[model samples]
Target: MTDCDFLVVGHGIAGATLAYVLRQRGHRVLVYDPGQANSASNVAAGLMNPVAGKRFALTWRGAELLPFAAAFYRELEQRYEQSFFSETPIFKLFSSLEEQNAVLARSADHPWGDFVAGFDTTDPGLPGTHAPFGGAWLQHGGHVAVRELLAALAVEGTRAGWLRRETFDWAQLATSSDGAVYAGQVRARHVICCEGAAAVRNPYFHWLPLTPNQGEVLDVECPGLSSAQVLNRGAYVVPVGGTRFRVGATYRWPPFADGITAVAREELAARLSVITELSFAIVGQQAGVRPAVRDRRPLLGPHPTVPALSFCGGYGSKGVMLAPRLAVLLADWLDGHADIWPDVSLQRYNTLQSVGVA
Candidate 1:
């Protein structure tokens, strides 16, 4: 039997980032991950965009989160001696003249002007792209090679004897006021559940309004369109390397609906066409269920009754961008250094005794 400060279940973006933060803060951490290929983190394009939706509203806490995420990834890159995060601009193509005007107007009125690199009303910006209404280049937007990043973290954790590459059995976990014990052995001061979309099955956290949103993405070979920047319209064309770009993703309700569907492929292809005039060949397709919350805010902190148990998930599509900062906050709360913000705290749902998937 071994003792540790934390035993984090599920090594998706949430768990991995939290474990890293905890370890950096001098806590002994053990991560348990079966490493499902279909997990949302593995399939995500890891695009970090500061603005979201058709109205071009600034992302929640974009100004604070973006820079912190960049610095965190850079520090990890230096420690790991590998490259995963890319600081690239996102070219958001305007769907209509009104869309363009609205974004420009918002930029003029708000602090979001700093994020807008430039905008063109005539030139489509990139060659082989079909932006008749032109587009805006956004700063502080980038990509993280998620799989590579996770793999790097796993390697480091494994070498440090802190990562267990096996399924975490809920039946074997026992929590108490003192702490948590797993499999009658490994004891931890706290056990955090970062199970991502699979949290619906977690007995301790299933009550949270966690809605699993199914999403799909495609990897394509676009020979005609070669650019370092991410091109966005209804869908996004993220350049992975060479002429291969990751184009996707389609959001569907009710998790695992039809798994990977032909309809999703066609939908992505249509969106890709709208982004670029260049022809592309679909090389691969992948799907995963994002752990979305009813309120669309991330779920963090501990259980109301079980002080030994906690949760750090419900990041949905923005896990890559949101996890780093949230991990810091969670760690701070765990260390009794700070309180979890009310909006994201799991206690926010204490009023609702029951929550159903919507």
Candidate 2:
């Protein structure tokens, strides 16, 4: 029977990052991943934007999360001897005069003012682009090649003989105060489900208000759009490589299935045209479901009654930035260093105990 200090289910950013940190801290971790192709982390464009939304409000906890994420990814790069993180600036284009005023107004404040590096009153010199009102250069904004990062982590975990590409069965999982029994064989000190959107199906964590959001993004070849920085207005166009960019990312609610569609493609193309008049060819499209929550905060901490069971999911669209710090918090709590933050704790959901778990 395999035995480990921790058994982590799911291999998305949440799971992979947690495992990476835990392993570095000298703990035995066994990761059981279903290897779902359309998982959110695999399909993410990995944009770590400090300022988001129509109001141009600074992201929740962006000030603290951004620097932590940067340093964490830097450490990962050094550890893995690979480069997947880049500090790419984001130019938030003004959609209207009102929006431009809003940016200026918000930039005059505390947190918002702190992140705005400068404003571009005139076009930032991108040919065939429409930025008459200009935009703001956001500080601490960047991109993480999330897919590459996950792959590297998986490779390292597998090479260390701690990762298994298999679906975990809850039916065989039995928890006690000290540890957990998985598949009637594997013994683990704790079991953390980081199953992303699939966590909604987890009997242990199904009660959490996880709203699965379907998002689609396109990869395009735009030779004329040579700006290296990310451009965001109605849509975001991020330069991933030479003459290639990651674009689109339309959000759909009811239709939570992970599948590409013509409507999303058309909407993305139209949005791209609005961002730039340059002709571009669509290279490909990818879609995935984000594990968002009702309050839009992460869901972490242990099951109220089941001490050996825990969870780390529902990071929504901000997983890239949120994972590192949140993982540290979860790992520290597990090791008895501290308690999970009140906002992110599963204890906030009073009805979880009522839903019942086997």
lDDT of 1 by residue, 170-264 (tens): 98998889998999989999999999988889887878888889999999998878476899999988999999999889988873565688989
Instruction: Please report how far candidate 2 places residue 49 from its true position, in Å.
Output: 0.3
lDDT of 2 by residue, 1-358 (tens): 8989999998999999999889889998999997776788998999999999977788988889999999999998998899989998888888877778877776666557467889987777766578988888898879999999898988877787888989998878999989999978899999999999888788777888898899999999998885668888778888888889999688889655549999999999999998898899999999999998989899999987788999998899999999999999999999999999999999888575676531
Q: Name the weakest run of 10 consecutive residues (lDDT summed) in model 2.
A: 349-358
Which pairs of residues collide in model 2?
A: none
C-alpha lDDT (0 to 100) for residue 189 of candidate 1? 95
For each of the candidates, give the backbone clash count. 0, 0
Give all TM-scores, in the order shown: 0.96, 0.97
Badly placed stretches (over 4 Å) of model 2 are 355-358
